[model samples]
Every structure is written in structure tokens, then in C-alpha cells.
Target chain A: MNRYTDEERQLDELLRSASPRRTVPPGLDTRIMARIAAHERRRRERRAIRSMALTCLALSAVLAVVGGIAVRSLDVVHRPETLVLLLAGMGCMALTVGGDRIGEIMRRL
Target chain B: MEQPTDNEIVQRVAAGDTEAFGIVVARYSEPIYHLVAGILRNEARAEEVTQETFVRAYEHLDRFRGGCSLSTWLYRIAYNRAVDSCRRRRFFGLLPAHETLPEPDDRPRYDDETIDRMRRALGRLAPRERALIALFYEEERPIAEVAAITGLSPANVKVKLHRTRQLLRKYMETQ
Candidate 1:
């Protein structure tokens, strides 16, 4: 075994004996659990909102496609208002589906 | 009753039994707090960082792949949080206040004066150096495990460990 110098031994003894041992605060558990609960709740709410938004966007896309087909079948695709409405609906659908991806890309930039 | 393993507890927490996480918090809070307090030397900030560490751990529980022991993983998270808190405080020109040593009544091994000297000497070291000392000596972690927790190569850890011990001894002698 390597022999420790007196100073090394003293320092080791001091480190072993005098290391600070802070008692965790009494209410730390309660505080952490409350924070965790809040976080879970917020995450659940966000997931709910995202799913709802996705459902709405899916419905909007279906409506836009159907409406576009109907307008084409009815020969009303020539009307500027119908065409604008169709384009806006399609744009909204794309934004809703790709919003998170767009945000990720922007952040990387 | 025998306690569940850390892996078991982690699996339970991931399965939505959030109460299982309380067991993890209870098991780790003291070491985590002590580690943070050792570096920051401020009880309030240490407590905050300790709490934040667990919160981050919980948030990323799924990412814990059991590559390291739970304690080591938790220490890694605590270490990062403490370093970040230290940096933020430094940026704001806020230095940690000198902390008082533990009361003699609490630790009958050393008198208040010796503990105080050691604490002061520890405080004089850089935050990472203090962390290295705490991990190696106070926590009784092996050099390899310390390297894993601190994200340092094992060889680097050995060099720093030797150098930090020398510095601590020098600092204490000067004090």
C-alpha cells in the first residue's frame, strides 16, 4: 500500500469526518410532488390541445378537399372567392400540421 | 418489506405511477443536496438546484437508459444544474456567501474550528475542483464512476484528482 504523508492523512480524515451533510428540507417531498403534479397536468393539457388541434386540422383538410372537388364538379372553380377559400383552408391545414416542424427549423437557424 | 430496485421504481414511474417517483426523491435528496451545497456553498441555491435537478430528471425519465446506476445519473443531472446555477450567479456578479460549518453537536468527530477551516479551504477551490473533491472523498465514489458522473475521461479525472488534492492541501496550509 502507498503510504500517505501526514498531511494527506490529515486531509483525508478531515474530508471523511467534516464533510457537510445537510438534512433535506422537511417539505422538499411535498414541494417536488406538487411540481411534478403540475408538470404532468400541464403536459396532459398540452397533449389534449395538440390532439384537438390535429383533429380539427384533419377535418379542415377533408372539407377543403371535398369542397375543392365539389367546386370543380360544379364548374365554380372559376370563381375567385371559392378558389381563395379553398387555398386558405389548405394553407391553414399545412400550417397546423407542420407548425412544430417549422418552429424547430427556425430555432436551428 | 424489501425495497424495490431503482430500475423497478423507474419503470413504475414511467408507467404513470407517479408516486413511485417520491421514493426516488426521498432516497436521493440528501446526497444531491449535499453535492450541490458543496459546490455552491449556499444552502438556498443548493436546495433550489436540487429540486430543479429532480424535476429535470422526472421530465426526462424516459431517456434514462440504465447505462449508469440511478445515483450516478442523478449526480450527473445535479452536477449540470449546479454548474448552470453557478454560472448564472457569476454573470449577475453574485458570489456565494461563506457558509458556516456544521455544528459541533451535529458532528462530534471534528470541532467547529477544524471543520470551518476545511470548509473555507474547500470554498477557495474552483467549483469543478470542489465537485471533484466532494465526489471522490466525501461521496466515496470510485475514480471510474466519478469520471462517468462528471463526464470526464478516467485519465483526466486521475490528473485532476491529484492536482485538486494538492491545491486543497496548499490552500489549507495557507489558511
Candidate 2:
């Protein structure tokens, strides 16, 4: 029986044996690639959803800004109309930011 | 063209060149195998989990950002699956259900039967504890990476790893 602790030595041997460069079963490469392909497909789907969200946010920003600006010109209540437009602009920015944050989180897949 | 780097391979895989992913898998299979096998202590189960690791990684490949190292991401999947399998086995009473259990790797071989006694002693440690040793020694991961892979905070990992090492060292001594 090996009586001494030699724990440190044993550890070194263990580490060396387990190094990532060790040979694996043949054709594991193929299996892994097949797996990655499936994963990428899912990832692409998520990207599409995120793109859709971004598109909605952009359209909403333009509509809100243009409508708010045109309303201010016609109403003649410059202060209130201006304030509303600025608030709408801020809201659009926030919506875009929120969607971006969520998109980043979802991208974690 | 120059041989593609790991990052390049990953990016290509991300770009939907599925074959490039073979490089990634071939790169890590051996280590991942040892990681899961060492933790689960069942060669067959380890192989199953290792295969599942790739399957799960594939299922969620789109969400993988390059923030953390790719190896770290793969280790995280391996660790989580090992933990889940242990929990499921426990809950299902697939094991003793009542008898006191040993550490994972129910049948570790010892050299010339001299270390066979020590093998049983080592098996007394918990799966997570055993996992720490395997990660540190077999995976050659730094403490910080082990913390990330195991989902323990660095400080906590340090404490657990230190304590686990001491236990193994001491256990080996007495045997």
C-alpha cells in the first residue's frame, strides 16, 4: 500500500490525465457539430424575435415623434404640446432600451 | 487559409456552418468526459451525461454570448447536469432510499488492492465535494474557473476546495 499522503503527487497525475487535450472517442467531432447546428437554429429564432421587437420599437418612435410634432404645430398650445412630445420621445427611448436589455438577456442561450 | 482559432470556429458555428462546431466538440470531448465521469462516478452514466451535455449546449447555442470563456460555459453545462442527475436519482429512490450512501464513483479501482481501502474512504465524500477535487485536479481549472463552473462564489469555492482537499489528504493518510 502507498502509505504516504502523496496527495499532492496524486493530484498532479490526475490533473495531467484529465487535461482537455487527451484523446477522445473517434467521430465525437461529428456528433458535436450536429449538436451545434441544432443549437444555432434555435439561436437564429431568438435573433428573429429580437429583431422583430427592435423593428416595433423603431416604428413606434417615428410615429410617436411625427404625430406629436404635427399635433403641437396645429394645436397652438406650444408648451403643453412640446412637453407631451418630449415625454413621448423619452418613452420611445425607454421602450427601445428595455427591449435591448431583454434581448441581451435572451441572447444568453 | 490559416488554421481557424477556437473563437473563429465558434463564430463560424454561430454563422451556421454546422461543421465548424466539430472543432469545438472535438476540442473539449475528452475533458468533458472526464469531468462528468469523475463527478458522476459511473462511466456509463458519465457517457450519457457527456452526450447530453452536447445536446443541451446545442439546444441553447444561440444564447451563448462570448462574455465568459467557451470552456467555462461547457463546464457549467456539465456541472449542472451532474447535479440534476444526482438529485433526480435521490428523489426517485433509485439508490438505497434508506441505506447510508457512499460518495459517487461507486466502483473506483485501487492500485494492487493496497489503495482499495482508500478508495472506499474517498467515496465517502459528497458528489459536490468529489466534483471539486476532479475540477481542480482533472480539469486543471483555476479556483476562480471552478467557482464559475460549479456556480459557487470564488470565496466559497476556495473554502470548500481547501476543506475537501484536507479531508482527502487526511483520509488517505489514515488508510
Q: Compute the DockQ of candidate 1.
A: 0.38
Clashing pairs in 1: none
Which prediction has the highest lDDT against the true structure? 1
Write out fnat for all predictions, comma-separated.
0.53, 0.33
In model 1, the Cα lDDT at residue B39 comes to: 76
Which ten residues in a row are the worst by lDDT in model 2 chain B? Answer: B97-106
- Which CAPRI category fits model 2? incorrect
Q: In candidate 1, what are the lDDT values of residues B1-175, reduced to their tens digit?
A: 9999999999999999999999999899888888887778777788889889999999999999999999999999998888788778778978645554443336677787887777788878778888888788877889998899899999999899878878877877788
Give the per-residue lDDT digits (tens) of candidate 2, residues B1-175. Answer: 6777767877786686777767667778888888876676665677778888987876677778877888899998998898688778778976442223223332233343434444444465677887887788767789999998998999999789768767765765676
Candidate 2 regions with alpha-carbon error over 4 angstroms: A1-27, A31-109, B96-111, B169-175
lDDT of 1 by residue, A1-109 (tens): 9867887787787877667666667888788778888998888867766666666667667767787685676554567776777678767766777676555544544
